[model samples]
Target: MRVIDPRPLPPGVLAAFLDLLGPERAAEVRAAAVRIARGLDGGTLWHVNSTPRGGGVAEMLHVLVPLYRALGVPCRWAVVDGDERFFDTTKKLGNLAYGSTEPADRLGAGAADDYLAHLELEAAQLAGVLGPRDVLLLHDHQTAGLVPALSAKVAAVHWRCHVGVDTPTEGSAAAWAIMAPLLDRADGVVFSVAHHVPAELAGHRVAVVPPVIWPFAPKNEPLPDDATRVLLDRAGLGSGPVPGNVVADGPRDPDAPLAVQVSRWDRLKDMHGVLTAFAESVPDAHLALVGPDPAAIPDDVDQAHWFATCLDAWRALPLPTRERIRLVCLPMDDLDDNARLVNAVQRAADVVVQKSLAEGFGLTVAEAMWKSRAVVGSAVGGIAAQIDHGRTGLLLDDPHDLAGFADLVTAVTGGAVDGTALGDRAHEDVRRRYLPDGDVLATAGLLTWEIT
Candidate 1:
């Protein structure tokens, strides 16, 4: 087996691609990323997931596969396709996986049967593109069914589960049963956190690999102050006084506190709960709800009804209170700009909020912390794992604790709590633990170990 070295890549070719971090931390992550890339120099890695756009899995792979090839590995990424019926079924399966009892009758009965059939068809279509000995990595539940179909030809198959899997309910169990055979067919399973691995797969060749943020990547890095100004202007937020600044600019008065929520507008993300908390908590603070309109919800469904309810909730507020809340629904195609805007918001805001009822490792939390911003997240799933509470960041148990959340927000923004210190610690924590280069390297190590 060839042991590829990560060094010797020309300067500026690949280094320019990573998100920016503190100098020492950036060097450490770069070295680790290079090492991981080098390990698979002659290996071919295939990553398959649902949807080519609009979600974290696809976004991560978009940047990740290229980094692999640049570092000398042969890599390819493919999206699994299905019609509206297929997606609707799979979407319910996702909710069930997170402990929802929603019946996936469409997905569970004939739709699931058809989905598997589609996978078999997809497998045949991909046969020519995939090398017989390539390491096939299937991501999430959508593509999990593909395993049994492709098992015979691949060198090793690894199922990467990105969500939490505590004690699953009956609905989840049924979905798992349909998917279990495919999982059992794989050489091993990879989970973002140890607790997320289903008990049945616990004793198998399981690897606990956390998702990582590529610091040098466009979406994750800090923009120049000028670029930040441009983004704020475009967002209609006008040049306001940034939290630490002496002068107040347009709508963003530097003296007032700024609180931000960056997540998909999905019910699982608990955007409604976030609004409720903010409404009761700090009326003086400027709140921005930022993210592309969620793609998970079907278009024909009453998505508009939900949005209207949220809008009505905000509008029903007294005039003064309503003015303080700004709900921004971003376009899905503008993810890069959205990411940069998020970085800018982190820099400008005094407190960052992620009140998710359920989450798959909440990369936005990591991204906020990376920007040296203090975060108050829900104590569910990986959010608890990411925050150290009163140290790196705060974790709220009852996301509806309006008063408590407000107090924390005021404490941090009022200079009573050291927001800067918290952000600084968060940056160090993410750099040491969650950088993407390290994740890829660790993944490569696991794959190599399994295959060899």
Candidate 2:
């Protein structure tokens, strides 16, 4: 197990929320966080998860840990070490949970042994340092196995699953076969949606918490018009003159509209679907599919395969249209730089899209919406819960409906749907419903419940 500093050197997560949440709400939030800190008589609140980079789980911890620390809580973050097999199995479970049709993968007895062995070793190492006064928080499936091992070591343990399939699927059943037993160790388990609570977990106390974006994070922060050019050019993802915004680092009409999606290079994100849809219907609009370099994210073994598949799809498009579409991998060596580049890309967009086949609440939607960019995404999982259909943002009835997606794209890019109006609604909705304050309060409540 490796203990690392929170990446991107968080810029006061609690303070960052002050402006967005305002004085009263901000003060109330501060009091809640402070209450947790003061209530912790002599123990630390420990957070455990997989990689501290690349995905949403990591992004949320990065935001939450700093805020809790500033509030005077002794919050610590540790990334569990795992072998490739461990990651691959976890990925299989995740894919199955997401309803991947590719023949469901299962963790066999030997594979299950391999998974437990690694977690046990890490748990032993962690147990040496933990005291009975400490509260252990195991995040997602990656750290779920450590629950039983650490149960006797810590004062309380809470397990939170950041990924879930709203609708039942065979893949989910297969994955849960290996995972359900681990939930037995959780004092309480948290999820992003109620529908994700499986039959085995029907009796456990479950809290459906929405994932939120810290507006101050490098990736979602506001960039000046000029910074957009410099950061975009620096990251090599895209470039533009002071006036053109970004044309994916290639020459294109200054007036041409742009639609973008920033997500991990995972099949579930549907980068290929976005590419094919753009090439076929929204030829007039430029598209950008941006994510962290696969080389930097050690856990995502499927990244290279997915990237190649998308690239192959991109090559199938007409030569002239190739210049209008960009398949980008931003450098992760510099977290701040990576975030600023993402911020520029999102802010430069006329519309943002997240056409995921499955999701645990698309924070990308909220990030883009916070930037006041209209979003068109599938009405599945948490995405449906975020956007109020036609009012805040557009949603597709069927995720596989590429033609309908194209029509939505055309509507946003054309003068028909008011992008600004939709963005306004989305931004406002996000402010009221999804924020770090809510997430913090929920965590505090959960911890308090377990302690009581």
Candidate 3:
């Protein structure tokens, strides 16, 4: 129901990618831009989601929306307004979709009605703003409830789901059963992977669109010397001069090897696992667990609970081992600054980790790899797509295998594996596939084929 105005992003980012992409791929991008210019269909494209900050959806919009407009595509963004109860139900459904072993909270008939009523009110507000030719694109389960009302009012409604179950579980099945009708109203749906498309979606058109990272965004771009040191020190990582040879990193000792994982304090990201793996095996390497400060975003109702649990896990470690591992909550007052801090942390890390127990797609994985940092991620969902095992990055066969994770960390930090080589290849993979330029073409092609 509430909309956040998008700030202007620097234009001409795509122009720089021409050299990175070479003459052939750059021509393809130019061709897509020409197609986009020809196929406006006289409509404004609108993207709808829950929050304006945090999460992959918001982060992507922060970059993609600007790029689209800069490329001469007419697009706008809106964030839905919901109460705690609504978000609580959506969060439960999300975890269920992931087949989380945590306690199950069912969304029965009454609960579904409660959820619909809120979306109905929000849709009432949307009606006045959407024009006859305008089309709506909703992201994730958080905004799915609006599809019913939006379908009748808009030219087309495409439900794009960012979180998904790679392997269907009873909980995920139950979630789909409840959402089946609301989903049917949409003209099309988009998923991160082919497997993420639910069986129930067979009646509608579906597209597989991988989650992407902006290579030139403030968060993904490499930081300069003066800015890197000032931001790192301001973020509480200390003011030591940044090492010129390595990616800009935190303060400790210039040459100290570091392993880092930057994600929400969710159970799935397995921050505790990263800490345990480092303490048990790679004791010589320092570990940093970084996440957004909970106070920065209001929607993630479970952040405090998850963060407290991670703290409990950290406190249980021995004092000597504990001092080597740290928990960092970066300030979000300045989003660009927050992004830059993340950039520095990832670059500074000797090996970046994304040890999620379950992942829809690891945007952070691509972010790390884009910075040319070798990543060790769990072999699940989009992470499997991003990493080619021993080529771009290493993949853990099993997420829960602490010993196996420790072994890989030890191997990477000990120089048994060529991390720099892995990082170089990883950068190339992103340049070829995961860059946001592809997203523009993909979105335009999808809407062109489906909307008309």
Q: Number of the top candidate by TM-score? A: 2
Instruction: After the best TM-score superposition of candidate 1, give how far the Cα of residue 427 lies from its true spot, in angstroms.
Output: 0.6
What does candidate 2 score on TM?
0.93
Arranged by TM-score, best first:
2, 3, 1
Task: Give the true-structure RMSD of model 3.
Answer: 3.7
Q: Which pairs of residues collide in candidate 1? A: 18-216, 18-217, 19-215, 19-216, 19-217
lDDT of 1 by residue, 367-430 (tens): 8898899898887778888999989998877655767767777777677889899999998999
Instruction: List clashing residue pairs in candidate 3.
Output: 1-80, 1-81, 249-348
Each prediction's total of clashing residue pairs, residues at least 3 apart in sequence or on different chains, is 5, 0, 3
List CA RMSD, all candidates.
5.8, 3.0, 3.7
Better of 2 and 3 by TM-score: 2
> Per-residue error at 420 for model 3, in Å?
0.4
Q: TM-scores, in order shown?
A: 0.85, 0.93, 0.93
How well does candidate 1 score on lDDT at residue 5?
24
Worst 10 residues of 2 by lDDT: 240-249
Candidate 2 residue 128 C-alpha distance from true site, Å: 2.1
Task: Report how far residue 178 has shifted in candidate 3, in Å.
Answer: 1.8
Tell me the tens digit of each residue's lDDT in model 2 across 1-452. Answer: 98767743445555656877999988878777776766566888888998888788788888888877776678888899887888987787778767665763555568777888889999998887788888887888788889889997787888888787877877788777778888787788888877877887877777778888887788777678778877766544444432222224355454789888999888888999998888887868888888777778887788888888887887777777887787778788877777788888888789999999889778888888888899999888889888888899999988889999999988999969999999998888888988788877877787777322
Superposed by TM-score, candidate 3 places the C-alpha of residue 280 at a distance from the truth, in angstroms, of: 2.6
The TM-score, computed over Cα atoms with residue i paired to residue i, of candidate 3 is 0.93
Q: How much RMSD separates candidate 2 from the native structure?
A: 3.0
